[model samples]
Target: MAKLYTQESPKQKNLQPKKESIDFILNYSKALSVINCKDKKFELLLN
Candidate 1:
């Protein structure tokens, strides 16, 4: 009888993001909020 040889499947990667990535996103949103506030103020001045 002949034996069959099969390759093993690869491992799956982590689905969740790391702490650094979460922190970066949070900081980015905060910065965008500041920019949005400035824009609102500028629009109010022009109006």
Candidate 2:
């Protein structure tokens, strides 16, 4: 079981996120928050 576990570890290492994807996700989250704030303000104005 120890030998099998050692072999599987390398596959897990490959699953790490690439820099570009990480950047994209962060930017996307920021953009989403901005949009949500605008939407809330618009709602308030309407009411």
Candidate 3:
């Protein structure tokens, strides 16, 4: 079991960066959605 765990540890570590990128993409989409909402509101005010 110890040997298995040692081998898997590097795989788990490699996944950390992928997780971070996913989180960043999620946050970026959220920001874009908020910006779109604000733009719509501004357009309504202009009209």
* Top model number, lDDT: 1
lDDT tens digits, residues 1-47, model 2? 45554444445545778899999888766555322564473222211
Q: lDDT tens string, model 3, 1-47?
A: 45553444434544445778998777776555322564473222211
Residue 11 accuracy (lDDT) in model 1? 72
CA deviation > 4 Å runs, candidate 2:
1-10, 34-47
List pairs with backbone clashes in candidate 1.
Answer: none
Query: Which of 1 and 2 is the better model by TM-score?
Result: 1
Stretches of candidate 3 off by over 4 Å are: 1-17, 34-47
* Residue 44 Cα positional deviation in candidate 1, in Å, after optimal superposition: 16
- The lDDT, on a scale of 0 to 1, for candidate 3 is 0.52
Cα lDDT for residue 23, candidate 2: 94
Give the C-alpha miss distance for residue 34 in model 1, angstroms: 7.1
In angstroms, how far off is 25's CA in candidate 3? 0.4
The whole-model C-alpha lDDT of candidate 1 against the native structure comes to: 0.62
